[model samples]
Target: MTPETGKTSIPIPERTRPPRAARRGAIAIRFRPGPAAIAAAALVCLLIGLLYLALQIRTIFSDQLKQEYAGLVLEAVERAESARNQVGIWQQLPDATEARAAGYRHARTELAHRLASLAALVNASPSAAPRLSPASFTADADLRDTDAVLGTVSAWWRAQRDADSADVRLRIAHVARTLIASAALLFCMLITALGMYAKRNRLLAGQSHEFEWAALHDAMTGLPNRRKLFATLEAAATKLSARSASCKIAVLYIDLDGFKQVNDSLGHRVGDEFLIAVSKRFRESVRKVDVVARIGGDEFAVLVREFSTNAELGEIARRLIACVVQTDLTMGVGMVSASIGIASFPDSVDDYHRLVAAADEAMYRVKRNGKNSYAFADRAN
Candidate 1:
């Protein structure tokens, strides 16, 4: 209450909040990943995996070629050693015959050819160049110490080959592990992006649905508005046109009597509450298929989809009148009553589009005669 104005203040009720579980459920629904997101993530992972696998296979192939070349070089070294030993044995013969001399020359020539081949192989290999070079084998002439040099070169080549093979295997293993970890990390990132995309889409869809509902329904009473009622009437007329002649549709335009007086005597808040209460009663008084809509302030329209006789519509009108006249104590301020005018397809109005106007005209006739009663459009006409 305000001390200066001496008027009591009514406190507005606080808005009720949703439960924690309900909020969590709403979040889960809004962010749940859709099939399109999952499929896109899977496609990205598959493409990356294929690219990585191709690179790994190429590395393995190159390493295999390296191993094959190393083996060939080792074989060349062995051949050179054998040729050198043959040349030495020929030189150590007791008789100095022409055949022995010719044989020694042939063996030395073969040893020189073998040594050139080993040098070419070793020079071609980039990794072997630091430890073994072409000059290392060719610098020693007369081939007296060739056997000892050959033995050392053979041991070095074998050790280098084993080391290279081990290194290649270790590198491939490390790359495989790294690739696996990178792919897993990429997959996780894609999934998170997919979830975010789905959540945004869900939020947009929810907002769109809310906008559509708000457009069609009355904001205060949550009932169908004038536009929705007209649309329903058009649909009902089209549907009944295809059926038998007995199937008919009707419209009842209702105007509240003495509502303005109540609204003026009491406040607008009471008027709004009274409207909501009566609207609920009007809705409850009709069948599930029937539509009760708030067309204007202190005015409503009811769509009866199918009715066999005028009496059936009259009964519905009486029910609506009762919904208003038998108001609860909370809303019964002043002498509030309902004056309803009924109009049916192929009877009061030739066209379905004119049904509401015809009913409205009849409702005004009721107001002129007395308030709180129902009348047919044909009778009013």
Candidate 2:
């Protein structure tokens, strides 16, 4: 200890950091959006709603303003007309200082005030601003509105000293008023035109549906044609594919046995009537769910969605033959019967044409045996 200055040096303390656990805890705190952020989002939504509400209010207000403005324009026009009449009377008078002249002066003042108010109203909205434009006021066939009338009045007020121009302006103002009246009806006409267009479209849609129906059906018998029958069969085949092996659909291909004889002996008119009667009988004999189609000529087809047994099919076929043969017609030809050929799904394969051919072959077999009988397609021949 060399105590030369007699003052000892002060020792500096070392800095200490926070504990590791405290540091980790501070860092691991997950920041989530708090109540303030939620409130801000809600406020934004409120603001949007308010803005839309304001826009709606503005639209309503603008419409009301337009109606009121139109009324005011009409009133101003009436006043101008009155003023014009007064001016005419005043000019006819020997004394220019007559009560009529004083009345015209008052009318002019009132017209000016009305015009100023109209201008202010037009200037209130940007869209309405067009109402106050020079083009809207011009004395032309193209320019006829509230603005044009107001413009004519303004021009007349300024040009009253010029007698000729004032007279012309008054006439133009009358024309403008007429145009405004007609213009209001223009809206109604447009609405009516739109309604007519919509009605025409609806009619066209109905016609289109009818046309499509006609294309798919026989005009005479009102039964599904070959195209419709094929489509229905294809759909049935798809459905049958999903069913159990035991489940089956039956196709009864029928031909009116004596239809040709009637068609040849009787007129086509009688034949058609007879065919129509046969179609009705066939429709009555089959179940409502069954599809009956007139493929062509006297050839017809019936698709039974689900037929359980061969006996059930035979019963339907017998009914068809009996119904047709029993019906007494105007024609001298006594009676006609149907030869039905039954072909079931899975047994005859799902192919529509092949099924029809098999049924047709079976029908020929029946025709060979007897005209009035029905037969099942034989797998062998």
Candidate 3:
């Protein structure tokens, strides 16, 4: 408790600056992929899986067709063998009767027709059929020589069928490998697309942050502007009204003395530099929680959020004046100083909305009475 004011002053703890790595982590946390990006990635994966499944199903159907073709070849070979057996049985009969002869001729014709059909089927499949010698089977061969010919044809069909089965398996494997490679390529493309999308989102987010910062802050001095100052005051007022605390919020409306002369005597570049230098000094003169804002030309405002006595506000005003005087010397403008007007919530005005106006009116009073001084809004008259 202060002996002079009889009010308790709550000490505000100093906020420590976070480490560089921790700040970077905070920035990284803000640019995560949204729901749309995740959903698109999932859909791409599903498409890749479905394409692989469809390719595999097609290979299975091809294998089924191959099996059916092999079965048909086998059935034709068996029918030819049965006809050859009947021809042999007819020729083995002892009587040379017309009926027996006719039966033998009929069996021979059937066997020849079946052999021709089997040869035609085998020849149709160029991938599986092997080149056979002309002497291997002939249409004019003797009826008694049918067994050797049938054996040769049977052996060739079996070999061809096995070769075709092996080729089908090889083809299926090639198709599977091709499908896998295609899927991998597609997956890579999708991943690239997702990365590009994420990068675009991050770029847009950074632009939005820039626009927001520009809206509330001055471009020249990098201080909060009038809009930002008003917003902060409104928030502080709401807090004060809710808590009904004894600690008060104050606005120090400051106008630079002899600033117009400097702008007229020196170039605008020098004037801009002068403003920047003084703004830095003003920022350094206050507590970490206090906000220093450049509201307009040659005018700035400092907000003191928590203070116990009027004496503390007076001290801040003195520091601001001294900082301006010191900065002006380095810039070769020795005559420059600050005219500050002090106003407080629940002290000068009933509403926080009038705080800045009241402070502005008080600053004019300082100008009228003599520059380079501070005065209170309530005592301006």
Best by lDDT: 1
| TM-score for each of the candidates | 0.77, 0.51, 0.72
As for candidate 2, its clashing pairs are none
Candidate 2, residue 182: the lDDT equals 46
Q: Of models 1 and 2, which has the larger lDDT?
A: 1
- Residue 249, candidate 3: Cα error in Å is 1.0
- For residues 1-381, write the lDDT of model 2, one tens digit per residue: 985787778988888889999888777665433344444554565566556556655555554555455455545556545544444465566775667667656654554554455555445533323445533322221312543565664554333324434444554565555456445454555555566567778899999999999999999999999889888888887887888867787788898887787778777888888878888888998899899999899899888888778899899989888767866343446857789898877666455557777788889888999878899987533
Q: In model 1, what lDDT does residue 313 have?
A: 93
| Candidate 1: pairs in clash | none
What lDDT is obtained when candidate 2 is compared to the true structure? 0.69
Worst 10 residues of 1 by lDDT: 130-139
Clash totals in order: 0, 0, 0
Off by over 4 Å in 3: 1-67, 82-141, 379-381
Off by over 4 Å in 2: 1-187, 243-245, 328-332
Q: Sort the candidates on lDDT, descending order.
A: 1, 3, 2
CA lDDT of every candidate:
0.84, 0.69, 0.82
Model 1, 317: alpha-carbon shift in Å?
1.2
| TM-score attained by model 1 | 0.77
